[model samples]
Target chain A: MSDLDLLKYTCGRTDLSLICDLIDPGSSVLDLGCGDGLFLRYLKERKNVRSLGLEISAEKIASCIANGVPVIQGDLDSRMEFAADGDFDYVILSRTLQEVRHPENLLDEIVRVGKQAIVSFINFGYFEYRFELFFCGRMPRGRHLPYEWFNTPNIHLGTLTDFHTLCRERHIRIVSAEPLGRIHGILPKWCWPNLFAHSCVFVLEKEK
Target chain B: MLLIEPQNYDFGPGEENALELDCRKKLYEVTLRYETCGKLNADRSNAVLIEHALSGDAHVTGYHTPEDRKPGWWAEMVGPGKAIDTDRYFVICSNILGGCSGSTGPRSIDPATGKPYNMNFPVITIADMVRAQKRLIDHLGISKLLAVVGGSMGGMQVLQWMIDYPDSVAAAVPIATTAQNSAQNIAFNWVGREAIISDPKFDGGNYDPENPPGKGLSTARMLAHITYLSDETMGRKFGRNLQENDHYAFDFRRDFAVESYLQHQGRRFVERFDANSYCYITRAIDYFDLADRTNGDLAAAFHSAKGKFLVVSFSSDWLFPTKQARALVKALLANHLETNFCEIQSGYGHDAFLLEIDTLGAMVGAFLANTLNEVSSGKQRGAQS
Candidate 1:
């Protein structure tokens, strides 16, 4: 692939851009499953945020190193090597929640490490996906969920409401719940986002 | 800017001799050196210490004449107005103990033997590295540090400082590192060591000065370098791309660009780094079990530390994953120490901290500024009270 194509393949996603915009510039950040270190590099340059990436791939870690980004190759399910107690201002899980086997435990870990955790997931409850399930009787495929079911990394598919309910059940305080869609080239409203939006971004905190 | 070349200058009388440190039965000699820039003032609390990674030198940031080929590895972050802000902070980077970069290492002539210690050099741990740093700090007469920051093996030294001499550091930033090496990590190190020793030219860790263990060391570095990156990054950058044309050459020559790149990295590294030092340093990293040393409690290691900490990790970095950073947060919480953790979303793998300058720099700058403010205000309140 060309350099531009590689860059686009690694980055060039609207959801990442939106998430980057929402994050406070100077806040400490931890990006889980940060692919190719693009978003972290973006946040570092534009926002001046101290960031770390936790990826599971060796090649990505090398690229991060080549680019001079700080990264660690590790699984999210295991105990981290970082020294204990609320070490980060924010821990971000972008486009990685669904792929994890036990997201609830991961969320608990995120809340434990950061004061606030921003989790962005593709909303499977969106009308287009629902229509695909009802009409075609198969899993939906779109810009967000591009891969076929067999080859897809997304294992834990859930809707906006389902995530909201899970957060409430787990006593996770919803700092902000917003929906995202390509509207005349802008993000749409948070409420009834499933109707018009393709994805949901949830900024949550552990309820004391 | 006035360029200073301390390496070219001869050390004043007795400076060349190594100072012995006898800790009971353990005897070790620390080789001390310093490079001062601008003025040497006691009131200027802007002193910053840059701890180099394994096989790194004292040169933190600078370009040695264009033809010299090798530029400072961190030249991007440590310039006048750069993220490290050399104008504001008096940066002091040193080659660590057990390192080949002008510091005490296996190659140094042992005072007792009169010959190079070779593999017979005392096995030093991360704590030993920090202990040597403490001596350097004491000799410099810098009572408190503005910040102690490092990545990978350097990050391990940063952690050791916080644990060993808590009061000396004001802020600690350990990026893209683990508190201790795991079994898998140890295995990787072992493989690299074996690769070096298995080489015919290694000569039992004392390869001839003319022809050192270049082949094996390069191969070891190539293998280790591969582990430092992510699959996605490699796929995106190299992606089975051929070196010269579309078709792969059937011969043993590097068929893919990635293979060529690895070969280049390995060859370049062998030119600058020593083979034996790699074996010793990797062993030190494997023996670095901070929790075990602190009685199976990582929190206890930082219990007495009063300074604020910034632990950073990168997403997609499997070598030192976000979970390790989270465990650090948990330990710090248990200790009730003021801390901030950030997992930057980066696909840069283990090297994200060095690459993602915008995020890491900003976060470090802001965190340091805030912590310094807190420290000043607390001192002010105490004075008023």
Candidate 2:
């Protein structure tokens, strides 16, 4: 298979296309927790944007370098003081916000270093998860949140309400919140998105 | 199979041209021995300066003589279609200021006294070595270089070049190096220096040329050679096998193959390296700390640097570990400079920079190509507007 085909097979998450669709051409981007830099490569090839990535895995970083994508081995939980204020047009955290130690601080850094942030995350308050917890009385488990509570990396999992509240408290402007309901059903236009949406993608900006 | 002839660029003769040492001393009549490969394009933007490590020299690649047993040190990474492909870029490698290989060091004559400088040779720093190279770069009539690349101590030079002449370098690749010398690094260097100084034949840095302090120098080299390798590589390469015997000699007369191998490495090193030169160069490395002038703020020290950067380290390079490379990458990023960092998996330890050419070479080749493309495209954009 070709590189693009391989990328699609490996990294074709539902939110990847959403994130790519939002980024404009000729803009600079920083991808946090960029796995194998598949999204960044896709952006570079199609959108013609200058991009870089921060990946924690050495193995993934090797793949990124082999494909000529620039990446640094760094943790998203730590302070991103390395990046100057507004250094990038966009900073992307794809389904990795809940996995970080300090999601609040990371969000702050994201909006500070990047003019805008493109964030995608699984909604813990989806109808299926709420129903599971209400009936089974166990930690939510399904296609998205697959791991058991003990083995899961999604320690700070939150619902759409929690994210929106945090954004308000942080004085961040949520330009748009894209609700995706892949497993449950077709999401009705803006009808109880927090309960209906299985996942969400938010385009955020620091309040001027 | 191109034969490369070494060339010498002499400068620092007049008062205005005197090179200042970090020790607050100025030296005149300096010479830099260098070699060039490939061609310099019309715009002179294809130049890539390759810096050598502790014991490396100007002979980066190609044959000095066809009958010679081996090609230059980095022959694996620098020929046509290689990593820093000579076919695509003009490559320059020079013996560092304090290096023994044809570069002016303790072995060079002190014009005032008409004798070798020896102990009198001013202690240099990584910055000083880079400054000397800058003079050569100026003499070559090249205003900007496509990249400055190196590993180990050479990596330090590449870092210094980026900061010292930020406008001159389009990109830099500092491999297997640290922003500052660590305490353990200083400790290792101290032991080596003590070995050389305590040797009876050392004669206060005035040893005879015919029969130098071989024992001490050899011992130092042996210890350093150990640092360049890891426990895994040592076990895989030599283990505890007896040398030339199935059973142990049961004596101190070199039974293990590892001992014999170290002894061979030391002996060969002494034949080609000058003891005093080793002392000065290692001391220079010891004094190296990029953040010294900025009150220990590494990020502040790199505020003025401008260029894309590729920082590389090895998984097993404990001497200059991945942590150090991360620190540098952080500093570069703090300045909002374009930086790419990777810690390659290898069992070759600190010496992996020389051995893991396939991965290192690919990264370097891509980085250089990307940098060139950006530069040209930027220029074209500028022209159109």
**TM-score of the second chain in each model?**
0.90, 0.98
Report how far off residue B257 is in candidate 2 (Å): 2.1
Among the candidates, what TM-score does chain A have in each? 0.89, 0.93
Q: Over the stretch A1-208, how does candidate 2's per-residue lDDT look in tens digits?
A: 2666846643547677778889999999999998888778888887888888999886677677656678997789888755778989999998999998899999999999999999997899999999999999999999889999999999998999999999999999999888888664436656787888888888999999
The lowest-lDDT stretch of 10 consecutive residues in candidate 2 chain A is A182-191
DockQ-based class of model 2: acceptable
Q: Can you give the TM-score per candidate against the true fold?
A: 0.65, 0.85
**Best-fitting candidate, measured by DockQ?**
2
Per-residue lDDT, model 1, residue B44, is 44
Per-residue alpha-carbon lDDT of candidate 1 for residues A53-107, written as tens digits (9 for 90 to 100): 7877655654554343455556788655562347778888987889988888888
The best candidate by TM-score is: 2
> How would you encode candidate 2's per-residue C-alpha lDDT over B1-385 as one tens digit per residue?
7799999999988999999877789989999999999999877888999999999999999999989889999999998989999998999999999888999999999998999999988989899999999999999998889899999999999999988898888889999999999999899999998999999999999998778999999999999999999998999999888889998778888889999999999999999999999998899899899999899999989998888888999999999998899889889877767688988889999999999998888788888887777666664122111
lDDT of 1 by residue, B1-385 (tens): 3353434211112433333332222434546444444343355455667777766777766654545555566766676777777766777777777778777777777767888877877777788777777777877777777678888888888888888777777778888888877787898899999999999999997777568898899999998888788998899999989999788678998889999999999999898888888898998889887797678788777777666677888888888787777777667656655455667788889877668887777666655555445444554111111
